[model samples]
Target: MRSAPFLGLSVAATLSGCAVPEARLRAGLIDAGLPQPIAACMADRMVDRLSLAQLMRIADLPKATASESVPQFLRRVRALGDLEILGVATSSAAACA
Candidate 1:
């Protein structure tokens, strides 16, 4: 997948607060076939504010099943409350954009 490289070193860097550039992260997510709005939302996050597990989940979003739309997947994720703990304001779909 296009995000393979991002999954390895970049995610680690992100968790450490020395994240890869936001543009690169967003492009990687886009290249992985994630919807632009979802990618934008995830890319805008402050990596330092998220836990390693949270970062990993975000990176893995591209692997979501074809049966799921981005909004549906995001809604499920939001329901988990992980994003809330990370301070990601996910009260509306617009927040994701």
Candidate 2:
């Protein structure tokens, strides 16, 4: 019975970790010139679909300049050569836009 309480706490901690990455991703998307709504939506989708390693790879991508468009941002993502990441990013952008 004591283990059950520990399990609950662990579950909470795991779930909390997920939020940090999602919020950071949303901010990154906004910085890349996507509107806030689109950024939020796409971040949610990408966070749910991609693994932590894929997300970290995305986080490592060069920051988007102020003049960059969404398509331009996607081109950089495509260059990563991870088809799953590219697909999630493209589909998320399409759905969010």
TM-score of each: 0.43, 0.84
Model 2: which ten-residue window has the lowest total lDDT? 60-69
lDDT of 2: 0.86
Candidate 2 per-residue lDDT, tens place, 1-97, comes to 8899999999999999999889888887777667788889989999999998888777667766675666987998899999999999999989988
Candidates' RMSD to native: 10.1, 1.7
Q: Residues 1-97, candidate 1, lDDT per residue (tens digit)?
A: 9889878887787565644555555564565456887777766763445555665555554544444455665565565567553345243234565
Worst 10 residues of 1 by lDDT: 85-94
For residue 19, model 1's alpha carbon misses the true position, in angstroms, by 2.7
Which regions of candidate 1 deviate over 4 angstroms? 1-17, 21-33, 46-48, 65-68, 78-93
Best by lDDT: 2
